[model samples]
Target: MFSCLKHKVGEVLLPGDEFSFQPEDTISLTDTVKPEKVICGPGLRRSGDRLLVSKSGVLRTKQPNMFWVDSQQKRYVPAKGETVIGIVTVKSGDVFKVDCGGSEQASLSYLAFEGATKRNRPNVQVGDLVFSQFVIANKDMEPELVCVDSSGRANGMGVFGGGGLLFRVSLGLIRRLLAPQSPLRAELQQLFPHELVIGMNGRLWVKASSVQQTLIIANLLESCENMTAEQRRQLFRRAAQGAL
Candidate 1:
């Protein structure tokens, strides 16, 4: 059953694609059988004894039984523990409403920040960009965002200062960019020195030595989503040659 799904990894699967688990052909009375468990992430769900694809995209898997789909989704879906870049839209009482490119705005508490207290609050204001993680997120309930970790440290999550440019990209591209030792990020770093903040909700913030350089990087990233790896390499080569 595990091998059935494992073999399909990296293949394009559409909605309604299903896989069923079956018992082994032979079992020995003296041998102990360990149950195999598989974890389904976004785009895959379990129904009865079968696994079903809920989205149309390429199947992806992580070691030790984790599976999901990498899709070209423009809209963001809030998920618990996902770090996202949100724009503060309203400040109401103790909670701030943040737009995370989702169906509804997520609520961020003033006390969610590091070192924040009733007497001394974090200097949050409307129109500020916050890098926060979702503490509570589900389809039936409103999403909640927090800037601090369980240890009460910001851990790189907090309000963004001025000067960086924020832009949108496909969610699939965002996943690729965030992958371990990502080739796209590696090539970009080779081009120039820059600061990049990648949000799971398809938002990216980039800053370079000059406004022109920042725009150049942003455009390159936005354009490469549909290009093949070789095509991206060719474009990077042109950029390295000062072709821009």
Candidate 2:
């Protein structure tokens, strides 16, 4: 029962001891006298008169559902329509390869660069950070990414420069730090006092008042991983409110 809540794979379930099933949820069950009934990864809960099961499984108690465990390996799975920040790593013919912190590299075409015209395509060099959306994840699981905005414009989608510092952190920490309600996020906003945060799956780009302020923000973001979700949210709120 205790192991299930921790999201560990291969945890065994006993009969009558209700366990939360799905991906990430707490397990609580009434101890049953019999041992024959047991299942894994299926939603189970008791109603007043009968046990209820959901085809989609249980609701994840974890704040962010972005994380998932598959085949006993922990990996970051990017969903379609999700906005992600990535860095350009290499260029090929008309496409640029980007590092999205996933197993396969994502591709952004030359035509997608801001201000690309029939005669003039903006030269986007390596190391430029771009905010993009997952356009396609083919059968092979390779992601095709794009950056065109709703109005069919590519402005505000490329090459972040100045006013901030960039740092690499673990993927898990990045997800926690980016939760909209995270306290750490709010605190970071206040401490640096600027707009426009671009968070990659593993890297962060922030704008600050000064270099010193940027360093402070980086340190704070790094420390947020060990904090609880609620605690992080509070800290972020305080930081955003200028308490940091």
Candidate 3:
């Protein structure tokens, strides 16, 4: 089953692409046999005993049997455990309605933040940006966001401060930026020092030493979404020379 699916990794697959699980190889009764399992991520679904592709994108896999499709999508469908950048749209009694670039606004409770309590709520206001993770996301229910992890620590999730510029990019670009040993991130580090916050939902916040430098980073990121590797290298070289 894994062999049938692993062969298509990194290939562009369209909707309706399906892979059937192959029959297990026969072994002696005395031999130890472990059950195999595959986890399907975004853009892939399981139907009966086959793995089905639900979107158009490149197939990608992670270690220990996890697979997903890397696709360029503007609309975000909330999935549990994915971190996202959200704007507080409405603040009610004890919850804030946040727009996470998803189909609907996700609810964020005041107690979701670290050290928050009934008398001590996190200072969140309307129009503020928040870096949070989805604790409850499903098609049948309203999504919920949290600023703390299971151990009740912030873990880098919280409200954002001023001075950074937030912008949008393709979901595929976000994935690449967050990938291990990302070439784009490495090249950018060589040019200048900057701070970047990437969200799985395509929202990015970037800040540099100056406003001009910040804009330069933002423009380069937006333009490189569809560029080839060589093209991006040449562009980066020109930017480095201009900065000197």
Candidate 4:
């Protein structure tokens, strides 16, 4: 099978755009044609032999021919193995209910933490934020959270995001910030020194040098989510100059 991989990365694509498919539009007798196998990711659909974009955003592709539309969305869908920042709401007998901004509240076992037992319980209070991964997430079932990985290692996964600001943003922005080669991250770093925790569920935690700087950083980041590279660079440079 074959698929179209000719478009440049970070190309903005709107709804109804033909993202990738077998080039039935072009046929050459001398050229061999192969049946294409394209995985229609989010914001895309397959109609007959064609792939159609169903969301408004830039198109993104991974190696080995995986494609998806990166659209700005605030809703969170629980998915297994994805770490998220959640707020504790209820402390049950053993499990704590957390609101991870998903469709439903997730459950976190007190023993999910590393080196935690009934006698060695981790101190967690209501309204506190917990950075944990989804251990079980299915559409038909409530999601479950774990503070440690399958190997019983914390791997920097735990609670305690003291003295920081938490806010929400589009899911697309979070993905862009976490991207390995995103130019935005570099430009942002040049602006100031700050720490950021991005949750896949459209939530983020930020801590900067001071309150003013933190607010500036947060506003700047929110404004840059939908901008192009040149636009983001301009914004970041202006912020660095205290124009924010």
Tens digits of per-residue lDDT for model 2, 1-244: 3234445333433334334434335434775433223232234454443334332322233422221221211244565655677889997778899987777888887776556765786677888877787778654777978777656676566666655677766765665556779555555555556555555456677666777667657766777767777786776667557665
- Residue pairs with backbone overlap in model 4: none
Q: Which ten residues in a row have the lowest lDDT in candidate 3?
A: 22-31
By the lDDT metric, which is better: model 1 or model 3?
1
- Regions of model 1 farther than 4 Å from truth: none
Which residue pairs in candidate 3 collide? none
After superposition, candidate 4 runs with Cα above 4 Å error: 4-36, 45-56
Superior candidate under lDDT, 1 versus 2: 1
Q: What's the candidate order when arranged by decreasing TM-score? A: 1, 3, 4, 2
- Per-model RMSD to reference: 1.2, 9.9, 2.1, 3.7
Tell me the TM-score of model 3.
0.91
Local accuracy of candidate 1 as per-residue lDDT tens digits, 90-208: 99999999999989999999999999999998898899999999999999999999999999999999999589899999988998999999999899999989999999999999999
What's the lDDT for candidate 3? Answer: 0.92
The model with the greatest lDDT is 1
Q: What TM-score would each prediction reach against the true structure?
A: 0.96, 0.61, 0.91, 0.83
| lDDT score at residue 69, model 1, on the 0-100 scale | 86
* Model 1 pairs in collision: none
lDDT of each: 0.93, 0.60, 0.92, 0.84
